[model samples]
Target: MLAQNVKKLIDDKAMDLNSQGDLADYVSKKITILNDYIEGKRELSEPNVDDILSEIVGFFTTSLDIPLEEGTKFLRARTYKVNHLEVNVPKLSYIPLDLSELATLGRLNKEKEPVYYGCIYFEEKGGVNVAFSESNAEVSDNVNILRSTAKCDVNVNYVGIYDYVHRQCKPRFMPQSMFEYFEAVSKYQEEKFSESVFLAHLLCDAFLSDILRRKKSGNLYRVTSILFSIYTESSDIDGIMYTSVKSEGDPVVALKTESVNSKLVHKSCDNYRIINDYGYAKYHAIHTHYGSISGNSVSWLKKNT
Candidate 1:
């Protein structure tokens, strides 16, 4: 389905040949130096990091323009919840983080930059909900959490990362746009597409090596956050979609706070209280609520469940 989506994007817009030659020149020259550095043929020197990042940003900008559905749902889990007794009270639990709350670097946002991070439903393998994994929430007899779900109320363009997992990872998705970019470059330069593809994969592995690591160290997020900043520089993109590291490559999204506040509607939320055995986890729904947006506030209705 993803490959077909890319094909449809290609069909809808004719490839602009104007930048093809320049893109080809840049990749061909950079790939050789990158390979030399990997092979220890030359001592590691600081290659132009911004130039490489720019090429990546340029590739996505030129290649695809897939828009997400208006009804797409995003699931966000919280270790805490709103403590209120009223049935129709305003709540901030289902909204994006406040500016003061967003003081650290996240998977895609820089320090102090507000972003709405959520796990999306994966249709492959019947269905998979990655919210728990993405939130790093583990429930047992002693642990429980609240989950807030929101629906996209407007069509938004989110830039997607093609399959980036190791080949050993299961269920590799189709049509990696990185290789496609290099292949297009190869076409203009009359270079072997396979060779360019090999270099492209090597580049991905080199640059994104720390992307899937489980550690939440601040330094690890520096590169990805920079990439996202570059991608959104045009203002045409509202967010980014990438594989969730904690969920074994399940799709996840990070939308700018402005985009989320303007385009997403709070749908519902559930409080799961675990009451099972110590080694096992079972969710007991303590409460459920349906949310309605008003002006800048969200009012909730107690749902009997």
Candidate 2:
């Protein structure tokens, strides 16, 4: 169910900004095109439609700015489960790490300004309830059941679970405000909404209501640098865990890095550049936002900060 909801949001963006009502219309068009391409009926890539898809992903990340405060807050509320997160999942909580070992990652790009979305370690879990995705070729990039691409078009990367949600779990159509108003109504009677219901409203606001609010109030934006904190731990769980407020604009996210130890922000487009203290290389990673991985970057950050 969660996967379906996410997919709807991603697919809807293929048609328009973030309206759930518009998702089917956009997806229908994408599927039709993909079918034509698969049957040798059309070209490989459509020109402009992909941009729309990227925009929709951005809207889901909670990074997109909606003008009205209610809309902004609503979008923030829905884009992710940042709630009860700190209480139940200690790992989900944002922690500041010492980049004194900054050379381990790379030379910080001291020039660029960074947008801050708190961090979480990216981890790879095993023996989980689900398995990973197959490949990007099996599904339409625009709908992105698996895989993603950036730069406004061309879906690339790991299979996205959100696309499943879009295809299977979209809400019945209604005006954005009206839909949420009903939520208020249910709560007004002191009704206890289920966890799923709460998440539904959060996601609904992120993809639908929030974008509408941005369109109306002039709060929409394009982003550049994205910041995330990578964490590491000792023992059996070996790898890295990276977390941040994930956004899905087709932008490449020219990376601007921040650290608790280093006061300055580093913005770098060169993913391969390495920084060494006393000519010794330690650790380095290519930067991306809302991305997933296994384990933490370098132990618990909470100890120092």
Candidate 3:
């Protein structure tokens, strides 16, 4: 009976989602200025850009259904220092960067906006390699730089940039029913929301554009940053999961600091080093450490070789 009931529930959800009511009509009505702007048919009026962005934010926040009840686990890496050869373990502060010290724009974060970033598995490589790749770590001959990465478990409810674009890798958290509904809505030519939804897709492409390269402050950062701020500000979305430009489409999640503080948990942190030779790179792990957080800092407790 339980198995039959589960099947019935799944079937009912499929049927209900298939019968989407007025979604295309509503989106078409909301994104008039943005649709015109993307089609190259007209120039945006003085305040039209702002209005269009508002519409985009509204559409994503309301139209997309994000399931964040289940927490997703990923690894976050940061440069680790051991007292220049003094300390023997890593601290809790090593888990994430201090937002108060933020000096530049990220692909999805404005300066001082606390977003905890993590990477998932990519091909044969695990989340650790993807995390280090996302770090843009450099290889130096004279200097030894160590990195510490932690496994972060949290409910990272996110918006994605993978569905409509060609990517080297697709994240596991990619939304299923919501995007298909948009695709169906985009095919409704009689309602003409097709063009509108398509324009919105172009905006999403910008979010993953090669121009907005990782770790560099591109000129378009302001625009993309605004889009991010607006999309995350009014919603319960804890993170924005997008493809990492430096990692060949590896998935990266940028979680809100508040969310990290409240929901993130990890059992251990691993220390490692990256060695670069000419054009090739190698990684070596040295130890794993455990610790706890206090007031605005962390203290390392123990370590294992």
Candidate 4:
């Protein structure tokens, strides 16, 4: 019964891939080879099993244009106990990407970003279950079932046990804000100073807001002031030099209190005031705000944090 059900699952998957024309022949041949081994007509070596798995993973990555590393993570195998029988199931989660905005960005300059959708897949003892959720839903579930298979008492050796279910997912790495900030830097390198400055301002606002939230002080004014003070003081030659030199005072206290203007009033006013005060001049103007945070400041933050 298990063998028949597994064959049906493979046939369904092969039918889906076969619809893609050129991939049809390849899928048919591989499925036949796997079925031969499963039926005991031929022996399946570990390398042969790996090759089949690679071909399966390649189908997804090639079709979706996703990186191989990211695509392979979706294919998994595990053993589960059901009615005292151990069942091994493999699953695949496919995520579709909206390259429309990315294509538009390639053609013209724009601030709009691409969107991504979410998809989840779970393979039961004999069937597959799928679910859809928001784009922000966590999809990278790195559950390694193969590693835990040893704990199972039943040693089922059917090749069909490695069969997987594919259901159409959603997407990370660097922080989006930092990515935009680096993009602005690239723009600056291209001599698009105006666009760079605009992006820099956006990044600056985001950075300050992030700090405020992380601190959770409820006093945006004080938080912004402290960050601005840290930036400006770090920019000074003496301050930069003294950072490396051991100081008499507590480094944390000095970082918080030093060079911050306590008298500055108004939240919105202080926000831009800190930006401009840090030397982020207008178009074609030198003394960039990016220069305000010195290497010493970064080192200090890294050490303290």
Candidate 5:
């Protein structure tokens, strides 16, 4: 189905000479990569389908001067029921990338982009509901489907919550926390270890605060304890801490346990701690250098979470 969708995307678009040539080149390279993988001559990692599609879309929209809406007509439309409301929202389907598949590709000599796709459905009926994608890649048209419809008074109170989560639920950690984390990483990459360590400690503190807010734990000591427990108990602390707890039952427990057991979570926490304690001043160091988190760590977080 996905392959067909991709092919449809390719066929539907009218292309100029340059665009056609680029498309042919891209497809030919991709096919060669796949063939090599099949014959065991080389290992091919799955490319991110959405990203590749988005790049193709970009070629049409930017290079060919095609309207954005016209360029994204090939994406599969999916209908989702808004919780507590009788509205059915239509959206483009997103596929999930699997880490195990990426790990398999990582073992190969050459770099391969993992191309797994899956959609996350909202099972619960209420609260601030927000759908997000990992990539900010311009894969889909930004034209609003709801613009033509009359605005209904569904739940005004939930609007603020939705907005908050929308901005916070970034690719990795919340945007601000992710920024700080990356800044620490950048410092480390620059060989400014002390500054990197300080920023890392700060990042950990920010992360803890976010967790406490989500958990609704206001007491500082309790927050600290919960954060510590989360770091210690779960391998995927971010997943465990970030996953919405819609209902209290086996489902939540199962999800929490699975996230906690993830190796990525363990590594993230371990790195956080390592950076936190690496500096001479445990909590008060002020650093000028900025660092970005390593790509491997970022990939791990994205995959595991």
Candidate 6:
């Protein structure tokens, strides 16, 4: 279904020579990478999965131009009142530290569990990305089915497949571009699309539950799922985004950064892992930052992940 979705996205769009060629090139690159991972000719290692999830999430929110302030809620109520999903979240127990925080970080600590952040539904699996944000890529004329476009140039295969496969759901609340906002978010009943689409179901479940709970409780606020904290040298700004969490506890957390020539070597985005000593973290894949509590960061870290 996903591959077909990619193909149709190719077929329907009306593009000029340059844009069409660029899109074709982009889709081809993704397909080649996906094929290798699917066939095991090459695998998206534990870290790579993190990278892909980041990109996937990026496609939905940032690259698609969906702002971090905008939260993805379920179209409707959930059928399965599954609350222990955190316990069942997908895991990669030994992904090495560098891959855990990010594929680029290059730290390797295999002694601990590699963290994984995805879920499986209806036999399909999906995960959120660690670094999915508009800042990572510039976006324009983002197209997803719910929104309508008379003529525009931005395109990606994910948006194409969603437009066709999830055609039933009207495009609601699109980025500044003209898209119809669904009066109420749609809901999936108890049936599944395919194993590949199961993760969407899980997301639907989690998001709906969150939206409903917030509606009732009122103190709840949904943060962007892909959380990040970054500072660019030219900008001289410290920015942070929290994912689906309301962490009002810590007022000040240390930034363990190094000064490289006049630049800073700071941690971009890493999930806090178990701390070894002196507030330094010993993490495997997907673990980076940890908070010190009760006079010890180690004990607190162990209980969190």
Model 2 Cα lDDT, one tens digit per residue, 1-305: 12344344444533343234444344445445533443456555323323433433343322211111111100001012121112211122112233223222211111232222221111211100011111111111111011111121211111122222334322322235533433333242123333333244344333332222121111122111011211111122111111111222111111222221122111111011112112111222211122132222212112121
List the lowest-lDDT window of 10 residues for candidate 2: 127-136
lDDT of 6 at 161: 18
TM-score of 4: 0.17
- lDDT score for candidate 4 against the true structure: 0.23
Q: Which stretches of candidate 6 lie over 4 Å from their true place?
A: 1-22, 43-62, 67-166, 170-305
Candidate 3 regions off by >4 Å? 1-52, 59-65, 68-71, 80-103, 121-125, 140-217, 277-305
In order, the Cα lDDT scores of the candidates are 0.46, 0.23, 0.46, 0.23, 0.23, 0.22
- Local accuracy of candidate 4 as per-residue lDDT tens digits, 1-305: 12344345434544454345444345546556654554456676645644663554333211101111111111121111221111211111111123333322210011132111111112321110111111111222211111111111211111110111010000122235433433433333224223333233233323322332232222222222222223223233111001001111101111111111221111100000011111111111111111112211211111121
**Residue 94 lDDT in model 6?**
18
Using all chains and alpha carbons, the TM-scores for the candidates as numbered come to: 0.58, 0.20, 0.58, 0.17, 0.18, 0.22
Error of 1 at 54 (Å): 3.0
Error of 1 at 2 (Å): 14
Candidate 4 regions off by >4 Å? 1-21, 60-305
Name every residue pair that clashes in candidate 1: none
Worst 10 residues of 6 by lDDT: 141-150
RMSD per candidate (Å) reads: 7.9, 19.4, 8.4, 30.1, 26.3, 19.4
Worst 10 residues of 4 by lDDT: 264-273
Q: Which lDDT tens digits does candidate 6 get at residues 28-108?
A: 354456445544566455455445434433332111111212122110000112211111101111133444554221111
